[model samples]
Target: MKRLSVSLSAIALIAAIPLLGGTPVLASLQKAGESIVQTLTRPQVKLNLGAEKQVVAQDQSGKEQVSWKSLEGNAVVQPGNILRYTVSSENAGDVPAKNLTVTQPIPQQMAYVLGSATNSNGAKMTYSIDNGKNFVENPTIQVKLANGKVETRPAPAEAYTHVRWRFGKSIDPTTGVKAAYEVKVK
Candidate 1:
């Protein structure tokens, strides 16, 4: 009878060992899964308009590499003059970034000169006639004529300005990106 009791006790202890060890492991796995889910669903984006500063450029490359000092001479003026500004973006994440878009609010003092924006990667540029309400490629005013009557229509607000660029490709790892354009300030 004593031997029988010892054997039964050993079997109970062996079974209990796995039960004890598995509870902690299962709990750890559950926590890890929750953490991964939270991370995947979170948004990772940082946007800010650089400080209002002046930029000046003497050459194309210098213009491309915009700086506060480079814009010293560029200002809004009447006809026969042009002003330029640069907008920059950065991939501040660990993974590759795709479909990168940069937007700049058209300063009230300037008007976007159609077809003035240039991109290094041949990106498609668009314009918004309204205050960023809508965007369209090759935006133009529509004219309706009926019985010798004509009506003019403007584009939505989300239209492109002189400095819109869509980096259709991925910005690798961690790097800063920039886009610039010349605008006529009225």
Candidate 2:
């Protein structure tokens, strides 16, 4: 009877081992599933300006290396003239980029021109009338009428101080991206 009781106890302990071990594994699997769901639902956007390729003198290794590329233009900008800079972005992750927005801070001594934005993807570009603060589709302006009534005025190109590009679909994962525009100096 003593030997039989010992054998029963050993069998019970062995069965308990699997249940105890499975708890951690199950917890880990649940955590992994939650992480995947978060990654899929989270909004992510990646920005990249195109690389510059230039010729450089050969080194002692007899191999030519690409030279430094500047983000700005090589030429100097005169006052009251436009200096264009391109800002590009791509959705490099597995999820799609929703409600895409691009903000370009106006440089000092520069004023934004109205309706000058040219989007590579037509109908995907929008202009912001209120600096870079807010964006809308076909944003309009409000005017006060002489009769104490409010009137709506179509926002002209000049009111457009910022350019925004809204993509209809998410950019492909891990793709080269770029967006550029011209800014005038006051």
The total number of steric clashes, by the backbone 3 Å criterion, in model 1 comes to: 15
Q: Write the per-residue lDDT of candidate 1 for residues 1-186, one digit (tens) a residue.
A: 999999999999998899778978789889999999867654344543432333535785554544543434453345534555656656666666778777666766666655556655556676666656666675666566877766656643324343456778776555656666655555
RMSD of each: 8.9, 10.4
Model 1 poorest 10 in a row by lDDT:
47-56
Maximum-lDDT candidate: 2
In order of listing, the candidates' clash counts read 15, 8
lDDT of 1 at 33: 99
As a whole number from 0 to 100, the lDDT of residue 75 in candidate 2 is: 46
Off by over 4 Å in 2: 1-25, 33-45, 49-76, 90-99, 131-133, 144-150, 156-161, 174-177
**Pairs of residues at least 3 apart in sequence or in different chains that clash in candidate 2:** 82-184, 86-180, 87-179, 88-178, 88-179, 114-157, 114-158, 115-157
lDDT of each: 0.61, 0.64
